[model samples]
Target chain A: MHAILDADYLCHLGFIRDGAPVVLPTLYARVAERLYMHGSAGSRPLRCAGEDTGIAVCLTVTHVDGLVLARSAIHHAINYRSVVVHGVARQVTDPAERSTALNALINHIVPGRAADSRPANAKELAATAVVALDLNEVSAKVRTGDPNDDPEDLALPHWTGVLPVQRTYGTPVPAGDLDPSVTVPGYLTQR
Target chain B: MHAILDADYLCHLGFIRDGAPVVLPTLYARVAERLYMHGSAGSRPLRCAGEDTGIAVCLTVTHVDGLVLARSAIHHAINYRSVVVHGVARQVTDPAERSTALNALINHIVPGRAADSRPANAKELAATAVVALDLNEVSAKVRTGDPNDDPEDLALPHWTGVLPVQRTYGTPVPAGDLDPSVTVPGYLTQR
Candidate 1:
C-alpha cells in the first residue's frame, strides 16, 4: 500500500455534495499512516473538511500498467495497480503539522525539492487548506500477466497479448524567467 | 471533452454507497455524448445502476501532462487535462445497445481491436453488466504552460520548470497459450 501510494502524487478524491457524489483530481502525499492533501481554502472538499466532524471521503490512486487484449472481447482487461482509502478527512490547523504536510506535498512531486524551493509564507499558507486522512481503511489491488482467453477461443484467428504501458519523463524545460546560471538540480535529473 | 475522454480508457467512477461516496477505477469508453462502462453483474455500482431510477455518479478521467515546479512551494502545480461528468447512470439491457457498448469498450482500449477479437458469448454477456452515463453535465479542466512563480521570488536561487509526463507503449508480449503463428496484429503494433 505504501509503495503504491508513494509511486504517484495524483489522486481522485470523492465526497458527497448536496446529496450527490463529486469526484475531483488533486495532488496528495503519504506521510507514515496518514495521507495529506492541499487545495484552495474555499474548495468544496476543503470547506467540508473544516466542518465540526470533518467529511467522509474516498481517495483513490490508479496506475494503468498494460492493456490486456484477449481472443474474446469478454476477456479483454487492463493490468493496473490501484489504492483506495475510505475515511473521514479533517482539516489540519496545527502550525507544525501544516508545515510538515506542505513540505511533504512539495517533495512528493520531486524528491529533495522542498529544501531547494522557497517555503510558503504566512499569507500563502493562509490561502491554502490542508486535509489529512488516516490510512486505516486502505486497500491495494493489482492485476498483471497476459490476457485471459477461453480455451475454446484460443484457436480463433486473433492476437492475444499484453500491451505494456509506461509513464516516461521527458527532458525538463526550464521556466522562461529562470536564471541561466541556476542549472537543473540533481534531484530533478536523477528522477 | 471528447479528446480528453478518447485519450484514456481508465476512469475513476464515484457513486453514493450507504450514504458515503465510493470511488472505483474502471474501464470506460465514450461514444458520442454517452459514456459506457462494464463490470461484473454483482458489483455494487452495477447493481445500484440497475435500480429503477438508476444511480447518480460522477465519472472523471485525468491525464497528468507534466509536473510543475515553482520557486515557491505555494505556487507549485501540476499540468493536466481532466473531464468530470455528473449524471445518473442507468444499466443498458437492450441486446443491441449492450453489444455496441461492449464493442466500444474494447475498441476504446485499442483501436480496431473489437473486430479482431471474438464477440462475447451468451453466458459471458449475462455475467457482465453495462452502464451508460449521458455526457450532459460534463466539464473539462486543463492546465498547461510553465510554473507560475511570484515575481519577487523569481530571484530566489531555485530551479523552476515543467517536467513533461507521457504515457508510452512498450513491445507487446503474447500470452503463453497463444498460437505462435498468430503474430502481433497491426492495430496493436501501430498504436
Candidate 2:
C-alpha cells in the first residue's frame, strides 16, 4: 500500500488497440482499491475503449533504491521496488465522482493541494475525461540489501557496496508573473 | 539529447505480443545514439522478438522536477522532462559489442563501476541476451517553472508555488558479508 501511494512520478499504462500494443505515461491517483487518471476527451485510448465496454489495461510503478555494485559484472543488479496492476479501465461519468477523482489526482502529487486550489468549473470538467482501474490483480516486487558476489571473486581486489538513491524536495520556485505579495506555501517548506 | 542522457532511473519499455500490449520496466543505457538492455535468454520479449528480425518498441524515460500547485485544481500540473523513443530493437551477437554494451550499462548506473567490477565470464555472457534500439524517432517534452492559475482565482486566499523535486545519491551501505578490509569505493563517495 505504501509503495503504491508513495510513487511520485508517472505510471506506464499499457493497453491494446487495433490489434497492436500501445503504452502511455500519465499521471495517476489511487483511491481505495482503484487508480484514476485523466486526459483530454479526444485521447485515442479513451475514445477507442468505448465508454461502456471499457478497456483492458496494465499499470506499473517503480522506484529504484540503489545500485548493487558486485565484485563480478555478471552478478551486478539494482535494488528496486515495483508494483503492477492488471485491470479493466472504465470512464467516470458521474460529475460528483469525477470531481472527487480529479481532487484525488491533485492531492496525490502534493497533499493538501486540492483544498488550497479552486474546484474545477463546468467547462473544464466537460473537457477532461476520467478513467478508473480497479485494483484486482496487483503484485509488488521489492529487492533490497547488497549485491550477491561469487565466493571465488570476493578475494579479487575490487570495491563493492550499494549506492543509495533518494528523491528530495528542492527550493520552491514561485511563478514569475505572480503577484509579489503572494508568499510560498507552508506545505511546500515541510517537504 | 540531454533529456535522454540525464535520466537517473529505469525506462518503461512497451511492445506488442499476440495482439495485446505488454509493458515492462527495465534498466537501460544509452551509448551514442543507441539504447542497450539485457535480459535472460528465455525472456518473453527477447525470445518472441526473434534474433535477426526486430520488434517494434517504444522506450520512455522521465524525470519529475516539481509539483505545480495552482490556484485552481483544474490547472494543477506537474513539472517534468521526458523523452520518448520509438524504434525497432535488435539482438547484439558480436562478443566485442556485447561486452562493450554490458560495460555501458554498468557505467550508466554508476559512472566508474565497469572498471571496478570483474568482466563477465564466458558462461555468464552466453546466458545474457543484449538488445539495442537506435535513437532515430525520438522526442522530448518538458514542463518547467510554476503553475498557471486563473486570473480571477488569484485573489482567493490560497497559496501557490512550485515544489521542486531532486534525486541525490545517499550513503553507501556495505554488503553484510563484505570483508572488513574492503572499504567503500572512492567513486561512490564522490556521488
Q: Write the per-residue lDDT of candidate 2 for residues B74-165, one digit (tens) a residue.
A: 88887888888787898888888898899989888888889988999888888899999899988888898877877788777677778788
- The positional error of residue A122 in candidate 1, measured at the CA in angstroms, is 0.7
- TM-score of each candidate? 0.98, 0.94
DockQ of each: 0.90, 0.68
Model 2: CA > 4 A from native: A17-20
Task: Name the candidate that leads on TM-score.
Answer: 1
Worst 10 residues of 2 chain B by lDDT: B1-10
- Mark the 10 consecutive residues where model 2 chain A has the least summed lDDT: A1-10
Model 1, span B53-121: residue lDDT tens = 999999999999999999988989999999999999999999999999999999998989999889888
Q: How accurate is candidate 2 locally (lDDT)?
A: 0.81
User: How many residue pairs clash in all the candidates, one count each?
Assistant: 0, 0
Q: What are the lDDT scores of the predictions, listed in order?
A: 0.93, 0.81
DockQ of structure 1: 0.90
Q: Give the TM-score of candidate 2.
A: 0.94
